[model samples]
Target: MTDAQDLDIPTEPLPASVLTGFLGSGKTTLLRHLLSHPEMDETAVVINEFGEIGLDHHLVAEATEDMVLMNAGCLCCTIRGDLVETLRSLYRRRITREIPPFRRLVIETTGLADPAPILQTLMSDPLLVERFRLDGVITTVDAANGEVTLDAQIESVKQAAMADRLLLTKCDLVDQDRIDALTQRLAQLNPAAPILQVENGKTEPSSLFGCGLYDPASKSLDVQRWLKAEAYEHDEGHGHEHHHDVNRHDERVRSFCVTYDVPLDWDRLNAWVDMLITLYGQQILRIKGILCIAGEEKPLVIHAVQHVFHPPVELPSWPDDDHRSRIVFIVRDLPESLFQETIRSFNEE
Candidate 1:
């Protein structure tokens, strides 16, 4: 919440939300409520249903045929063919103007699905990485059963840890003391996410969204918060903040900005972007920067949503005389070594 005078507001497109949770976490109920919002009418939904019956579709009444259902149920396991192929087809439809030009796409992953692999598909796939932007991740927790679920189910813990927003549903069923204790435990698990209450699938959409790459209203981007938890309001657990587990995607995403003193060789910069976006772009959730090269007074801006990066934009004038290229990256399961190695390799050339 910087003051207007100090803020460097952004002007970019908003990414869609990725809602996930364990079974009975009320993810479908939340989606049903979200889709009911007048603002969500233009949103296309992709639901991953796990069971043979696949009754989740019947639960969502707002979406038309716009809802695409994946039969395998888990995104990580199904995406190699089913997930990737389906998303690719959807991309063509959107770009070719075949569909209603959905402003947002909500991918509702199955309760048991792991998010990292799904994120990987979105980032690695050439057809998708650039075409669709991952807005944010929202995870719902059963207020009454969360502690037990977290204790017994490691996947639920992972889901909660990675979420940008944590919704505690069934609040009416739990007492105040129990809710307070649950919040305390959740703080230890993942304090970076803001906790919101939901009863009967009713809550404000605004509180649940805009936790992604760019802030729609301000247009200003905060890479730290988007990839990691810098944008969150609280940090209660020192252990969770420094959790060093290196699994495919354990909510320990980290982000930082790099500055260059000299104006970059446009060709070199482009090459770096190409190599990184191609090699590990899927690992990189978001990348953006303002380039200040030697010859140009105005900055060259680069932005990427998932792996689909938009073309660079040359600003009308220099925002300031810093004359340093500044780029920020939101990377998941990415070590600082990757950035170091990339920089060293780029400079040796």
Candidate 2:
């Protein structure tokens, strides 16, 4: 059992992770393997259609009309209505003892769906926000056909870029050279996210869960682990020439890290972030960082999906000795120099 098991009976807000990937990327297969684990028994899964997953093999008992208790003790539910309503209903049932009191949640999105909308939906809803906090996004990428998928569908590229954890699935079907190439590409696409090679969707639940800024078991902010800004420091920003020439649309997408050596002014930082998102919310895919505020001794952690920013939280103390602020951004057609200049101006003010 891992730290995720400590959350079996959530004392505070439960963490919810969004599982997204392209068609045939093995999301369902990964999810099925996760549910089969005894440690994942306390988790609840929400999907669009029950028929699509074919979970009858793991069926244990029916909890209600739309929800079922799985053989390993997870509660599986189909969306009764809109996502907001479905999540609300699940919360209600959990409190009322209508279903198992699952401590964590995993929402599976459709292959072609843009995950930003789903993240925004959860953030906009006050009730959902109070009951659940985003753990992180777990995206599955097929090693066999990931390159083709990314070339053909812009949505697949977004899915890979916005992920907090990238699961490289079907690696057994591809050669080392292909896997190596795809791995390098994924790193450039999302340097902050950790890529885990998964064969036949076989992966431990521990590796996929608890990827957010706050680690429940540690009871503190894990800034370095969450940010992984070091990845960007190592990136030389090369190799996009061939990709850019082939797929102009994906070439516009950029992932980079911006840093400030001095402590950031709270007021100015807020204004800068507000203006950036207000002007280019649709273009921005994900934003996350740990800040060293001017007046605050402890570091502040922030995360956002598109225009919706999670309320910034302050840690009791710094995660480590390093105190410089680092912010990572995944955006489309947004110039890095623009971000650097804007923030630089705000800092000067």
Candidate 3:
């Protein structure tokens, strides 16, 4: 067995994204559309099948062999070992010129898979983390059955909660009223993610990728767009209050922002965050924040998916005149009052 710490970390990490959703949520359909796009020319794909007999590979239109180069120039492959092994193999092949040069990678998870574990694998595995960077998460929502699925399945709710982009599929089959209601429900669960209607799984590739703090095109930190604090503010100002429903599947999941006007003490804030994640990591689905520290010259960017946290990066300057520290939390079964109180206690000390 290979020891995790013994593996070498790559200097230049490849950007990779996860495509996940519930069963029959149109993940494969959307993937087929993406694979056909010219923009996905230098991309590699990995599909994970759940049962003994794997059939997801056949569902992809142009996928034929273990590694198939589609007409549009993208490469498609199934998961060989696990997610980590597959990523390592891809990196090794790219290094040795065994495969075509690929710029990005996309992994499709089984409908029943919890996105958090895959995300954790991406961030936690030392070898994988060094070679592959988590670009973002794209979740496909079945508009026709989204509402019912969300109400009946907890896994479906989790997929939406952890998504960076929520793509609504099968819009043509559903009425506008149903779509609107489902949209509202999704917003309550994950206010920061932009929901786009994907017709027949066709969507602009630009919209799905580049969702992380580091912009692949500009090679710079696009903190404002990535944080999306303005969206949270707008939702709050417009009285888009999130109501907790007793009967809904995501009744326990909530999205809210906690703001601190005073500049935070770096050491104190770090300690608080460490403790928070240690205690309630499972409940804290996602965390993104911009902080103005008392002694720091630039704003600090923090991102966490469940218990795993990316190393904090400091931007050259603040995005705007607003210097207040804003931390947005998307949590499940974690009360806003508890979060507020914990922060308040930290600030007081």
lDDT of each: 0.68, 0.79, 0.79
Show the lowest summed lDDT stretch of 10 residues, model 2. 68-77
Model 1 has an lDDT value of 0.68
Q: What TM-score does candidate 1 get on C-alpha atoms?
A: 0.65
lDDT (tens digit, per residue) of candidate 2 on 1-349? 2244333334678889988998789988888788779988888777543343445334323333334322222122233236777788787777666678888888877676677887777766798888888888899999999988888889889998988899999988989999998888888788888899998888999888888888666777755555877777643666334344445356777888899999999999999999999999989998998899997888898888888998987777887888999999999988888899999998895
After TM-score superposition, the amount by which residue 209's alpha carbon in candidate 1 deviates from its true location, in angstroms, is 1.8
What digit string (tens of lDDT, one per residue) describes model 1 on residues 175-203? 99989977876654554567888998888
What's model 2's lDDT at 255? 87
Query: Which pairs of residues collide in model 2?
Result: none
lDDT of 3 by residue, 105-214 (tens): 88887887678778877877898877777888899999999999998888899999888899999999989999999999898788888899988888889999988766
Give the true-structure RMSD of model 1: 9.2
**Which has the better lDDT: candidate 1, or candidate 3?**
3
